[model samples]
Target chain A: MPIEQDYSKTENGTQPVESDNQDSNKTPTLPSFTANKSSQTVNTLWRTLITPNSPNVTPNSSYYELISFYVYHGLLVLLYFNIFIFGLITFSINRTKLWFFELAYNPSKSPSVISADISKLNKIPKRISVILNLKPEETENGGISGLISDSSEVCAWVVASGIKYLSIYEYGGELKNNIPELRRSVYKKLAVYYGTDNVPTFSIKVPHANAIYYGASDQDIDQQRYKNTSYKPILQIVLLSNVDGRATIVDLTKVMADLTTTNEISPKDITVKFIDDELKQLVGEEPDLLILFQPYLNLQSYPPWHIRLCEIYWEPDNDAVTYPVYLRALQKFSTCKVNVGK
Target chain B: MPDWMSTFPGYQQILENCTSLFASVVRTGPVPQHIGFIMDGNRRYARINQIEVKEGHNAGFESLARLLQVCYKCGVKSATIFAFSIENYKRNSFEVDWLMELAKMRFGQMIEKGDLCEKYGIKIRTLGDKSLLPRDVVECLEEAERTTANNSKAVLNVCFSYTSRHEITTTIVNILENVKKGLIEPGDITEDMITNNLYTGDQPPLDLLIRSSGVRRISDFLLWQCHQEHCDIEIIDTLWPEFGTMQMCLLLLKWSFNRTYGRKKYRGKKETKKEKEKST
Candidate 1:
């Protein structure tokens, strides 16, 4: 809800005195001489501070008139001071408007001339590294819908350029406050994806200590959804052994449906068998050369896997990552590092 | 007047009366220094022609050569075209393999013919992540760049596995590491410091960026350097192969005219006229 509008005091100057019954018999009282006694203290201090070697004036003159003259002169000075400040403010606003117009018309002009004096863009390399928490248990946000965007093409460029060393931040880290365990889990997943050995060289810790909030509960989807939410829910899997390393992810929804044969709960579920086959097809027979994980997800929420995996039980932030950024991060990661699996 | 001029409306009369006026406009325009092209839509073009994706790429390669000639004639000192991106390698294996072969074969021929250096005095330079490319393709690119290094006519930058974000970040990382190593002072790092560290260190800012195949987005081609000064343009219904000298001429003419005839003065007179009318 937006806040209610309130501008009665500013827009209109009417005092509400007669409306209330308590104030009907009360007469407005003028400020008394007692109030002026404390104000005279300020006057005495000013005179003491400025009256050193002061020119002698007629002592018989009215002190009230003298103080009134001084007050009027002070007020006059303040009026002129305010006028000067207003003029400066108007000039500044006009100058800024002119500059903004210039920037829009000639965007190619070097921004340094008009921009504030700041350090070189080189000094601070603000890097954004994206990691897709593909594990189904990780979906607190609405499936993969928030993870993919049109920037996949840019991600391709990043990979081709051989840019490694990215800042891996958990998406929506600020919403939940600071979850150290989640951060650790995020890095662990990266280590697994890039291989544990390459983790030290390829990724940097997300220095921001923050929490992302979760809005959905695990039971929001299907009551039995918890059973299949432990492992990574893959989208497309790619394997790159020759030429330029390019891989695609395998589809999961159909595979899972194909795995379920008996509509009853059983140890030998067809879904696990399907997952194995799909993983094999995507990663190939190579031991350390390929891997699979869904890039963009939607519909189903990713379950909290770290809590289940370690059995410590920690709640996952539902709003931790958006789909578009997740997709972009995967693209950027693939572009930067040559995932040499071990 | 040429036969094509007769087909036009006002141009027909202008051709008869004022011939030098057209030449004068051309001479006075500020010719672009470097013109870059983001070649798109080979697959679409291939589909339209009932051809394979490889065939579309081959057609694109041919279009590139013709475009280069037009760029040279326009007095453009440098021209860079995005031939292949790193992510493009992730497509179907057969298609990706064909593209690698195509780059090697086409670039190798251009190098062997000495056409780039001997005929046009142009120097060939390859940009982007060369390491990600096949060994054979890398070798072909290196030979081409080395052979044409001494040429002074023009610089042809073939952006193969390039991403502007990676390039900028790489430069920044290098600068950061250099500072940490005590090899350079932090204060010494300027805008030029970052620019000089980039792959195209010796080149100037792009004047015009033309994406063929009618795509509006640049797709992270040249990120940090290109926001303000460059024009990102798209041509409608034209594949890279079909884009000829005429297309390049039209684009360059429009760009040069804009640059030369750009305005800087404020529109105070119009405001004053409006105010006078409002008062009445």
Candidate 2:
């Protein structure tokens, strides 16, 4: 079948349907053939050649049958080939078309919002004991002013970041009994978005006396604070029983020394495998990021886990800064590439 | 020993407990491949020491250098450290200028000596908003990264002015653009696909996340990737300048022990004759 094209309209705007076959007056082009008569085989094969004026039915009916067979088979082969090529072209074009559309629209817009179900998953899966530094003298406000501000900011930040599971360390006095005030403030901000049922706050209390606040706290008393603070049931927290009540680099230096002697491995010889092999067994796999609490930044007293982590320090200075710092740390996870030694 | 370290009688016990915990953990399962650190205590360290704040940062850098060696010694293949964050730019101009100078000098010295990369086969990579940094600092970082790129032994990621949220957004933009270009299928996009498109695509997942300054929070580091329920090792109450390999080992050991124990329990349950009969 021939594809149709509009050719009936004249410059005068008159239109009519016309037949396309108008080649009857023209001579047809034919393939040329040559033959040599020097061979006896050719000479004996035929005495004369038959010629026809046109390909019309004539006396040679047998010749017509052979010609028809070749024509039919040739047309069938051409039709099959055209069909195969067309199918391939269609498939290729469809893929190209889909790609064009996908490129025009951004997929990030289609990102699924974090679901509310995430809150239901926030059961106290892990018992984490936070060491609430109550020494008002040590902490800028004797753990009152700075404590509330810092704790509120920290808790709010964590809650805003979608962390619903935590066992906050509570100082038994006014803070423990009136803890609902802090909880209400945090949850009010949190529950507005996440809903109260999802962001359920949980707390743990430690009995602390004000007499200890007046510089009369013994080492045993301080140690008790430390021991009581670790995430319990599964994890434990031990506070530093010291006058300064700070975990410092000096503490870390000591730990490093002990590790060198006990494991007979120097810090200089550590490897990713050594850390990974151990961590994979414990946590199963690695986390994408790590945040550490810097109470005083005493390297000696820092948590032992900083060894295999990218530590983020969360020490609030007098400036009371937050947000942008957290955002910046979050950005690092994406921009930072593992220096693949090419 | 330093006065602070020497004075602590519990230091030895903590070290012993840490080692045993780590050893036991490792005996159980696999550990992290590449560990990244957000070193966050130069100013506080300085304030405590009553020294110039710059000196505290310089000391922090030294601590990072030592920590790298420790990571290598402990068999960690890659370690990324957050030397500077975008928020640090809010500091006084002079301090920021000094930090840039220190970074340039440190990178220059490392490249010149060829010792850091040559001996340890360390490849240095940087992550952050490069546009915000001084041109010279960016140039030095690029050079450092390029020079160490061929080293195969270990990788060192230096995140300067980095933020995890920006990274995620950037990846989203990239994915969207790629999809538009017909280079990828939109429906085929998944979490792993996003991970592959991230700046740290080549790096492995963070095995253990440790933050310094003894404050408990991720502070917006790796929000998307770390959101998975079971994929984290979070430890609060550590500072960047103060952390060491012993800490790394302890975390690793704990991770390993958990895996090994879980696997053992699983195998024991699977191989029980009664269980097999019940299944039949």
Candidate 3:
């Protein structure tokens, strides 16, 4: 029952005092007259019970009123029961999903203890992207080689987990010269895990299911445009500065301005469709999951247009990237309800 | 009628007492000056309840009313809600029409003299491209804005037919036009100049952003503002209609805690750096 109309106004306000005894004392005590008055009172009571908000109607004054009370209260109880049941079902489902996730990816356990069985997990995201913040402090601990080894380990785990696409972005460093070495190491690690024949083959002639590197230069982007071969289970290593330089909204603004001038169209006529097409040609499809290997939730100059609807998972400790942590991020992404503002 | 009822005055009194107690507890924390909401999950709520989409939107409106009242009591000054978006037009015509009708009705209520606007002294402003909306709906929204023009207690910014990308693009176009007209030099186009051209330029930077429906994404709503301010984002699992006062209070408490202790370390460093620069 709605709370607004649950109670009668008379219940909150003062009720008028009844003068039944005084009226009876002043009138003659005739049995026939008293019988008729009693019948009239019963009729009026029945009328009030049948019609809501009737003038001179006092609720809960008779047996009919008691029945109505039970009806209303019973409906209210049932409504509450429905709400309680719905809440319980939702809670148990969420609890079960979380329990399953924790069972598979136990954070308390060491990285070796958590096995990488992609089939056993509840869900695996098709595309997984990780942003590694190679700040001075991070590289100072074990040098650039340590960062590269950590990224390679992450890639090996991603391949082992059967993710179709993996992307690794390194921020705060000039890594253009080291791309070949990093790619070779990642390929070697994958070969060790999946054997030589099972490892993804790399070829500069074509965009194959292999490790590819993109640098922070327009030439790299132009080179990518020519190699349009579709490859599954490909690993893309991108420098964060490269994506930022190429895929920033500022670039979109430039494109919009040029289009407005060249095409002789109003700027207001430009929509996301035009911008999206340009972005798709620049940056590939948005990743299903974005994992930030940072101590805090910072984008680290990530391109904004690409991640509008991307699910972001952050590792707060900036700890070594582990297979279990990667799996857990994928699981979290799968459970998320992408409402899309519908 | 009942023995316990005899001891207590009424349920309303008990409710008021409890509300005041909750308010006092919330008063201990720092309230945000501006908060943004991505109101999501209405259609899902309707699907779960097996009700019509229109009824789901109505329930969402009820929740919005309750949330606004709670925010007012909690001392929140300004709130921007993602009520409608440009992408929403892609939905089926029936749903789009229903939503427009709902907006019209709600705005009509706001335009009426003695509604929540009068009671809470809320200044309502529709922030978006109005040309795309129905004429009657736009009229109602304008009338509501005109009616509550002088309100100073609180501000409600309804992002109807709005998208952050479009807003940014529009602002950029405005800047380019100004430069072309020689009203402003191209070199003088600073961050502040672009910001002042935004629909929410006069409003305070967002302190917190809350998205309901378990989705962990910004959905192109206030992307630039949130990214610029580094606003704390909280994604709640509950649908928009089910996001009640208690949930809002919990989110506010979390925001207050983060503001007081979490981000202060980095903020302090930045402030000191600015101070040293000024001294030099």
Q: Pick the candidate with the highest lDDT.
A: 3
**Which lDDT values do the candidates have, in the order given?**
0.46, 0.48, 0.65
lDDT of 2 by residue, B1-280 (tens): 2549846888867755544433332322255566767666677788887899889888887777766665564456777676776666777888989999999999987766656667678888898789999899999999999888888888887878776655655665555555445575545566566667767788776555556765444444554444332344345445555666566554555444434333111112323555667899
Point out where model 3 deviates above 4 Å.
Answer: A1-116, A119-127, A133-147, A161-188, A195-233, A241-247, A251-269, A281-284, A293-301, A314-320, A332-342, B1-29, B190-192, B263-280
**Tens digit of per-residue lDDT, candidate 3, span A1-342:** 123234444444433333455456554565534544777788767756664442222453444444454454444344345545764686577556555655666533222233344555666677677876443322343446766777677766765565656656554433444666665666666666667656653321111112344322225333464356564324444444434522355545554555454556565665666666665555545677888765445554455556677788864433446554577677787677664544
Candidate 1's displacement at residue B138, Å, is 1.2
DockQ-based ranking: 3, 2, 1
Q: By descending lDDT, how would the candidates be arranged? A: 3, 2, 1
- Fraction of native Cα contacts reproduced by each candidate: 0.00, 0.01, 0.16
Native-interface RMSD of candidate 1: 26.8
Error of 2 at B121 (Å): 0.7
> Relative to the unseen true structure, what is the Cα RMSD of model 3?
18.7
Highest DockQ model number: 3
- Using lDDT as the measure, name the better of candidate 1 and candidate 2: 2
**Order the candidates by TM-score, highest first — what do you get?**
3, 2, 1
Per-residue lDDT tens digits for candidate 1, residues B1-280, read 2458558888636632332232222323466787778787777789999998888888887778767765665467888887777667668788878888988888887876646456667888898878788888899999988988888888888888776644654555555555445576644556566667887778877777776654333465654444332443333447776776556666766565446445222113435656888999
| Best of the two (1, 2) by DockQ | 2
In angstroms and one decimal each, the interface RMSD of every candidate reads: 26.8, 27.5, 11.7
Report clash pairs, candidate 3. Answer: none
